[model samples]
Target chain A: MLEISGLVSGYGRISILHGIDLRVEKGELVALVGVNGAGKTTLMKTIAGLIRPTAGRIAFEGSEIAGEGAERAVAAGIALVPEGRMVFPRMTVWENLMLGGVHPRARPYREATLERIFDLFPRLAERRDQKAATMSGGEQQMLVIGRGLMAQPKLLILDEPSLGLSPLLVQETYGALRKLNADGLTILLAEQNVKLSLAVSNRGYVIENGKIVLTGASSDLARDPATRKAYLGRL
Target chain B: MSAEVLLQATVQGLQMGAIYALIALSMTLIFSVGGLLNFAHGDFMALAMYGALALYQSFALDAYAAAPLLFFGFFLLGFLMFRRLVQPVLAAGVLAGAQLTLGLVFVQENFLLMVFGGDYLSVPTVLSNKNLVIPPLTMPWPLLVGSLLAVVLAAILYVVLMRTDFGRQVRAITQNSDAAALMGIRIDRVQAIAFGIGIGLLGLTGAIIVAQFTLTPAMGLDFTLIALIVMVIGGLGSFAGSMIAGAIIGVSESLGSLLYGGTVGAMIPYAILVLVLLFRPHGLMGEH
Candidate 1:
């Protein structure tokens, strides 16, 4: 489980995330939906410790982890599959995965975790020795997700996993997310793809201008008149 | 020119080239990993040489025996420098980092000048003036031994970069620092070690070459320039490229001196560097 409250963070002096309050229960997939520049990435980064929060608390399983930095966050069992599919371009898929398991907590389970990841993304297994940069975009996306799993994380945070992906690849990615949640993994996914995200998540929050504008069960938010009008493009 | 003379020149060039390669490799490592130009790199080598000189003067230890001590001492000094100075400016930009290191050049040069004065100094080991003769070719022991040790150090460095977990982390950081952090790597720790190793290598270079060359307080700038030329010619971050480029510069300089004159030979590396930049800017082994 993870809890965040009044989390204010940004690049330098300009605050992008202002007083965000969010939470995800154990074994739940929570979607943070927002348009471009709506502070979704900022909130995720703050939780993952890539950006130090200027205000508020981030509690991962009851211990405060605010501003602990990315290394400590990963050691505390949080793995972030960052936006833009930032795989080490020069490294092979196996090398990327091996690095993903470099955390001490994950190192002991690296072999086992790698096998599970390979099972989840067989394309990665087939291209184990291939450089990540040479792989197709969809395959790179799979590699990043598989890399996150290699960390054996208690909480997996993903930022824009479906961005730049083809529709078919997007569906496949969402399906993988669904499967991951079904396997009792807790996930925090930030996305602009409202329809697919709501469909896959148990609970969802609509963020706008660095504020949470709506929160409810996935189905309820999907059908809500305002949510439908703004996000789903329907009434 | 006779064939024997040509062969001798080539051999001598290669021996010097080996040493240049080590210096260039150190520069490349720091640049690739820490993202700093490390203008103080050559000064660090000069400081290492002085450390060896001091050791030799005090305990009558040969430069060869003082090498391990210099290597580890410089490593620690480099590590501390990164933590205290380099890391802070790293996020500011390349210019900021370069300026910080450039400042270090003055500090180190001044410190050495005050302690040792401006006189040229050399360490006299047993092998200082000795030469190994074989038929028509004779190799000075200092140059021969220095080149061999340089190659051995380079091989050890290669193994460390290719085989170790730290090496993997280093490569990971070089490719993508953000992604590396997401993978749980302590970026600062890895970078500090890398900076240390980069400067620490100069320790080995300094100790080995102390007997081969005379040291002046201002000689650090020349080595820095040579390293910069070598790094550029070899490609910015390629390890193999630096070694090969170092050899190319050394051989050309050696042959240039033999055929033309000392002035022209000194200018040869610059000519080659310009040609490399004009024709293949990325370097021989660099990725586009």
Candidate 2:
């Protein structure tokens, strides 16, 4: 459902992603894995239109949307659960979700979307009125993902949803994400959670220093000698 | 001052307090949401006053009839100008945004001078300034009308900000712009609407001001300074703060005039703001 070709982006004058290509078909989950500063987050941000691309072509459902702003990206049915669980801290959990459905892209499906989010994360419904900041790290991450779901995005780009969570929490989070994928949501999972991401993602790309050094099927990339050495720590 | 004069002064203070609240509320909304202490806020109010004067002069629309159009028109101006001009500079930093708004004030005032030739014009008052004398308490018609309008508008704004979907989005953006955007709450559109709404509120305040006081382009800085003091004392981004601070400022100035003189009364707001900052820098009700 989404395709990014030769994507190049960065903060003003400091180029990060030189030229990278990635894609996700409808109802598929693709994981982009990299170590620290791998430019995975930057790639996701560029695709979501948070950062303007110096050079790239991002096509979502057959339309170019590379340099459009975040609002437009959401309107085009793409949602980015930004890095670090950037929930509106002062807002209630329900309000955050409500805001997610505010985009024109999700307007038609808001009621059903809310039901889906609540169904997937029942904890959210219980704490709907609670301020997002007051929630635990794992809950906040879920809230962020649930908010992305609220957009009824055709492609959901989750940037490091497992960061800072305990191993058990990460397991639970990934479990929920798996169910979401099974339910037919196309996802771009950007993370350093190499094992979990590779396990769930249909296809995988290994990025380092703003370039994708390797791309292959998740199983092949997982067992590749270089991938094992650098990412899986199996060497 | 006698009992009657003192009572009259109190009434006048309350009336002035209402106008101050309206102006401060507009200032608070813009400063909080736009993330800039736009000194040009008062200029927009002046622009609305000019708009009203022009309409009154050309179409002979009374102040009441002209109010709605003035509100919507200046709101549109604020919305467009913020999107096209202010938002870009705001991305640079708060200081850059302040400079951009200051420049805007200069351009707007000069435009007013160029078009209107630096003259003072008043909106037609629908009623004579006849005082209702109640022996101990006398109320002017303009003050009564202005106070009524201010109270009604504030209540309406309270609902709009606290009880509506649009308001929820605004509060979200005000708290965290990046987070809001991630949730698909369009930051640019929300800010544009906020600027427009903020200025629309200011336009109404301007109409009220022209009803009771004479307006000049240069008075913008002075009026803005007072509104800034109110916002600061009330707390940045706190609507309740601005409202309470408005009344406090009004009373302090009134009492100061009675105790000292007009100059000391005028100076008290600045003095109180300094004291408030020294104690509670965030404001009476502002978030840290």
Candidate 3:
């Protein structure tokens, strides 16, 4: 349950996100697909409060959270697994997960969260003391996902989870995300993996530059000829 | 070299190094988490020493006796200093923070000169002129006590950082401030507490200075420079490394004093730092 209206954000004088509007209903797996430099990351970052919006009304579960810092967003039940697995490289695997649980609300349930995460990603459990930088790409992805879950967030916004991942790893990661959605966790999936994102997500939005160009049911968009040609590389 | 002479220099060097370690640790603490070089740090040290002077004048209390009061005073001073000086410029970037601190140092030095005058004042603690004799080696009690306290402080600092949840949060901030804040840490509050502690540690050093040595209002810059050199030698973000480097510096300074003269020996840390930076610019254990 989130609503964004006419959001504008950017770095310095260079405006990367034009006025954009989007929303997500409860327990919905919504996909936002865009090509490189298409403002996908910018939009996600704006909602998550990494970058302050010059103009926006971000309502999370009916509370206005526009221009709030990232910590406030996390406290308000929104977690962003930023692009490129931005895990603390020098921190130990266990430490990274512990960081996710640093909020007071999450502190009491940290052990339980750790147990669930360990169960979900057994590889991380095996290398608890190992530094995150040493982990393989797939493992690091799992670690970040696990880290986001540690916050017990109501809405998890992931930017390009499949980037730099092998096809099998992507499928596996998608399956895990699908399972998360099925378990009633609302997710915002941002990626260039149109087929995978649209397949797993119930609804999708296609973006170009800083504008939303298309929006509809994922299934219908998948069958759409123009989207197929433009995004899926089909003639 | 005779064992007695060698032992004497080593002992004095270690003591001097320990004092540097105290100053260096505070610098590293603020630098790592707060992301400012804190040019005003030595001014804080000067205030502590001045505080002792005030206490001595008003209450006729010994420096050691006034230590607890100085510690809390400096803590409050540090906490408020961060709120006024650091918090405002924090968002503007590290350069702003650096300049703000440097400005604060100028203000403090001028204020001290106005109050205390330009004269150099010597502090004589209870341990002053006291000596511990052991066979061929007889050491002054002031240096011995200062070094002992430095080691103890270092150990305590290590434990607090390595063994507690608060320490974990500090390390988190050191590594990633944004991530740390997102984890529900009140960054401002934590930074304030850390700044307070960093300054509070200077109380001990101040006491040692007042009781064992001498000071002038203009001498704060030297401490700041010494602390920076120690941090650079130890590595910017490494606590243990700083402590070790401080001791090494103290011993080297002693060696310089023996080889050259006192004035030339004082120049050793800078000359040595230049040499070290020429090769290992990141420092002996710098993360960079």
The number of the candidate with the highest DockQ is: 1
Worst 10 residues of 3 chain B by lDDT: B176-185
Q: What is candidate 2's CAPRI-style docking category based on DockQ?
A: medium
Report how far off residue B61 is in candidate 3 (Å). Answer: 3.7
- Against the true two-chain complex, what DockQ does each candidate achieve? 0.82, 0.56, 0.48
Native-referenced TM-scores of chain A, all candidate models: 0.98, 0.96, 0.97
* Candidate 1 regions with alpha-carbon error over 4 angstroms: none
Which segments of candidate 3 are over 4 A away from where they belong?
A: A12-14, B90-93
For candidate 1, write residues B120-216 as lDDT tens digits. 9998887899999997999999999999999999888888876777888999999998999998899899989998998889987899888888888
Candidate 1 on A1-235: residue-level lDDT in tens? 7999998889999998888889999999999998999999999888888999899999999999999999889988999999999999988899899999988889899899998888888899999999999999999999999999988899999999999999999998988988999999999999999998988999999999988999999999999999988978931
Ranking by TM-score: 1, 3, 2
Best candidate, lDDT-wise? 1
Cα-based lDDT at residue B220, candidate 1: 89
True contacts kept of 3: 0.46
Candidate 2 runs further than 4 Å off:
B1-7, B88-93, B103-122, B133-135, B184-186
lDDT order of candidates, best first? 1, 3, 2
Q: Report the error of model 1 at residue B210, Å.
A: 1.7
DockQ, Cα level, model 3: 0.48
lDDT (10s digit) by residue, model 2, range B60-84: 8776677888888879888988888
